[model samples]
Target chain A: MNTLSYGLLSLLSHSPLSGYDLTLRIQPFWPAKHSQIYPLLSQMEKDEQVTFETVAQSDKPDKKVYSITDKGIDSLREWLSEPASAPVLRDELMLKAYCVPLVDPSITRDLFQSRLEYYRNNLQRYEEKIRKIKETSDLDEGEVPAYRDPLFGAYILLNKALMSCRTNIEWCEWVLSAIPQDHT
Target chain B: MNTLSYGLLSLLSHSPLSGYDLTLRIQPFWPAKHSQIYPLLSQMEKDEQVTFETVAQSDKPDKKVYSITDKGIDSLREWLSEPASAPVLRDELMLKAYCVPLVDPSITRDLFQSRLEYYRNNLQRYEEKIRKIKETSDLDEGEVPAYRDPLFGAYILLNKALMSCRTNIEWCEWVLSAIPQDHT
Candidate 1:
């Protein structure tokens, strides 16, 4: 099965949600486009992994809300137990760092400074989200029960991301200093 | 221009090399399949960004050694000055971390421990290569030159990779501790 399918199932396991809702909810974990999510939802429905019901509404168009099936939950649990594959870090800045000696030192300094800004902003955003999640009770946020709450899982993810940004900034500063000033 | 194309030019800027040789040289930065490299070489030659000359050898079949054109060098420098794009970190482990509360904690703990091992091995391998690179001078291993050397760029890349792997193993250990023992 596709990884995205499991992500959708995992989201539905929390609560029944529309395709649009799924698109927004999954962004923090997996930033997939809506175009990708809608088609996958239909495919999962055909495969009997997920089922959708059209909920009538007076103000908006009828929405097809999706929920995970028993098969989907079983599949998710199986996947969760299996080893997680390593990600290919197609990092462009790291790629640039590989070519920095060919360029002006000032260019690299600027790039590092910009990245420091970018990751600082990213780190701040994740920390704010983590704080918000913690402030709300499990019931208020529609979380899985405290025993099975996915927020705990999300917390671990956010914590790692926060740490990664911190590491990046530190490395960038190191690179800047390592390059000779007279070289520029 | 394709990122891979610039990577090829950057490699050629160091010295003229055959397609297979280029594949080996570029592996430390961007690992490309031989299939991908050969076709891109042909395409780049047609674009006037690269040119090749066939050299016959007494012991072996003729080999086409590729060198970057002036146009290619200009293109590479232009690209070097441009802002780097953010890579999509499609990290599956982080994705798994987002759902860990749904599975047995022992499974995640085991996965994290295994990952710690994997990255620790990776860090050691890169560190060894870095040490080897530092100890050797020209003729010891054919280096470009002290002036136009790519080793400086490569050193930065290796340092970052080493730090990244270290960070990953540390994070894995932290995750193992963060998960409550009773969760299993």
Candidate 2:
């Protein structure tokens, strides 16, 4: 199985989640579309890595909720033992940033301004999530969850997201400041 | 044309480059394989967005050095005016991080330790490049290049890379600290 398949199994290891819930939960870590995820989930079930139950919903159509099997946990342990592949980041803004000399200074300013807003919004969301996690968990101020705790993984991941988001926001503001206020 | 197509054009706007050079230069911003890049260059040439000339080398086989056409510049300008699509970051380590509690603490420590090494290597490379840029460009200490300068884009992009790398390194160290020293 590919990294995404292993990623799906990783999420299921925490708790059984519907495919929709899995889709939402996996976004910040690994962005995969529904089309890609559904087929992978089906293949995983066939391989006995994961098993799903048809959960009936009153207002919506039935959904498949998947849980990791023993086989899945074994696969995850194997995958974890291997070195993870390098991160791949494809940002259209970076490409644009490379050619900023071709555009107006105002256009350049707008590009970074909007990106600043994007990061700010994400910062707010991540902060809210981390605060919620703190409220729910027994974590003390400046204290991390124990390695075996269920919240340990989520705690660290949220911290990474927050750190990265704030870094991007800072970079965007720096870029904006560098741009001239008016086209000369 | 896809975003990669525009990305290639964006790079060409700075200077003409061979497909091999393009593949190498784009790696820091958009990681693409030689197989993927050569085919895209051919397609871009067919669409008249770029033109190429065979440059013979004494030690190596002749290569096609591509230069952006007026059409390519127009395309890049159009792309720059539009808001960039959201960045896509697919990091396998993050997936593994989300399931860290499943593995031994030692295993988790190894994962972060290796990632820390990776970021350190990158940090060194970026630091060296930024140093070279500073030495070559007319930029003063803590001064940014003008928007119209050829080095402006590279300058900002490198700063972003450095900032992001340092942040990641900080994160890995923090995670490693959080993990217990001895398995309980």
Candidate 3:
């Protein structure tokens, strides 16, 4: 099964949304191109996991807004309950690091420095996002915090990303220093 | 160009080896399936990057030991010098974390716990490997450590994996604690 299907299902379970809306929601973290999204939505519709209704527009093309069906929710819940597989890491930096001893030491140092800069920038961005999530998740006056609230999961996900950025930055720094000044 | 081609070139630069030997060398870190390797070797041979000679065996099928050409070495070096791309992360755990709020909190908690155990086990394995690398890299008397020695790169790679495991375990622990004790 397409994993993007599950991501869309989670989004649609919140509310009926057009393909554009789904793309926008996922772009903040897990980006799916419109080309990918539209096709997947079509497949899901054929599979009866989702259904769409065309809504007319005054000055634009009609939009097909999609919502998750009962089947979609059941599928999403089941997958979420199962154990996740080991991540397939396609990390280019790690690959480069593996081969760096064969190249110039100066080049490897530059690569580590470049990666450190990237991760540090990401750290700042995720930290800001976590702050925003905390503010958004706070209950307003007369609002009830339910145990089943899905926003809690969203909160944890952002925190995990934030932690990941921090980890990457620290790892980059350590690798940079550990490389000998006259490394082969 | 096939990414596996570069990995093979890096391996063969150390010494001439058969396909089986190459697979064994990479299995500890950068694993390439035999199905994938044999074909890529054929292609690399056609590209004039690697050459092979058949060796007869009495007790088994004849082996084709392969060696990298100067062209292959140049190609590997060129690619390593270029800037590495941002990693394409396909982390299933992150996906599950994103949807956990839709499932039972107990399930989410269990996911975090399972992930913690995996990282912890990985941490121990990498730690031992790091120790072994240090021992191996230590030169005996009259041995020269070349600046271009690939062992240096291999050492760094192990360190990077060790750091990654540490980062993952720490992230899992933080997420576990941040989750409310009574989450639904």
Candidate 4:
């Protein structure tokens, strides 16, 4: 399963946060929907992993200020201690890669060229996001936020993911060139 | 869905094949069980993608000899021409990479180390398969059997994935050293 729940815990471990804070800040990394959110929040509450107090806002939507319980802290701590699983490489690209050179070398070459462009676009996005963050935020080296910042981990994740996209593009280009260029 | 069906077309594009030959020769790259085999075979026949006729065996099990239809070739051609889907990278290792700095630093370090080892193992498996192919067949580079030949593309994919893993390990090690290096 997609580990949004774990993402929720990671958020709360930084500090008590509202559902709104989670939706804006953490959602960028984990990418959850309200459907996954409300249910997970209720389940976490039922499990006594978190407690939320209803907060009213004068100008905008009211919010639930959710705080990690002692149990939640322990859970996050345990999760942090446990070993991570192996990479689950479910690459549809691999399917395409296999089909090509056999079906029509011309088509395969064109497909790979397009994919290279896609990666280049992604790399641009990652670089832009990094630049924007650097200009806007006061992040120190490795960004050790003062005992209450989910953004720290998010920043690290973004950097790593960006590197991955760069590496992917580089690899894809190398592979594209290595295969004999066949237009037909 | 797992696109093992492509392997069948790839094989048949080269020549007619029996069901047993499919199970034996084609199953290794894109794996399937007996349960999945007959159903997909039947579906292909109804779709007029493949023609199957029973062939009696003198001493072995009777087999359905399957040949690609003209329509099948056209379908395969169209499939090759269509834009391939973007790679669906369900990388649990990447999530784990996010988890690493959040998780115990030492455990995270150990995990990457193990991952590095696993990648090497996979590379060895690929190498071993390639060697076995060479030993068993007199097939030259251009004359290689379609499904049986080593896909240089697959090698590049594996190579890229491994390089990413190695780079990740290096990054993890650097970060781990920079950190307090006290936690396990």
Top DockQ: which candidate number? 2
- Tens digits of per-residue lDDT, candidate 3, A1-184, equal 5777887887787789999889887764456689999999999999999999999999988999998999998998898888877765555666566667677778888888888888888788877876675678775642323436666556666666776777777777767776668744
User: Individual DockQ of the candidates?
Assistant: 0.43, 0.89, 0.44, 0.29
Q: Where does model 3 exceed 4 Å of error?
A: A24-32, A53-63, A139-147, A178-184, B21-32, B54-62, B139-147, B178-183
What lDDT tens digits, residue by residue, belong to model 4 across residues A126-146? 788776676667766565332
Cα lDDT tens digits, model 2, A52-124, are: 9999999999998999999999999999999988899999999999999998999999899999999999999
Prediction 2 global C-alpha lDDT: 0.93
* lDDT, residue A107, candidate 4: 68
DockQ score for candidate 4 = 0.29
Candidate 3's displacement at residue B86, Å, is 1.0
| Better lDDT candidate (1, 4) | 1
Candidate 3 chain B lowest-lDDT run of ten = B139-148
Q: Please list all clashing residue pairs in model 4, or write none if there are none.
A: none
Candidate 3: residue A20 lDDT (0-100): 83
Q: What is residue A146's positional error in candidate 4, in angstroms?
A: 12
lDDT (Cα, tens digit) per residue for candidate 3, span B57-120: 9999999999999898889889888877776565667766666667767887888899899889
Q: Model 1, B1-184: lDDT tens per residue? A: 6887888887787789999899887875667889999999999999999999999989988889999999988888888898877655666677677667777778877778878888988989998987777777432432322323577677767777877888888888877777667754
- Model 2, residue A72: distance off in Å is 0.8
lDDT for position A147 in model 2? 89
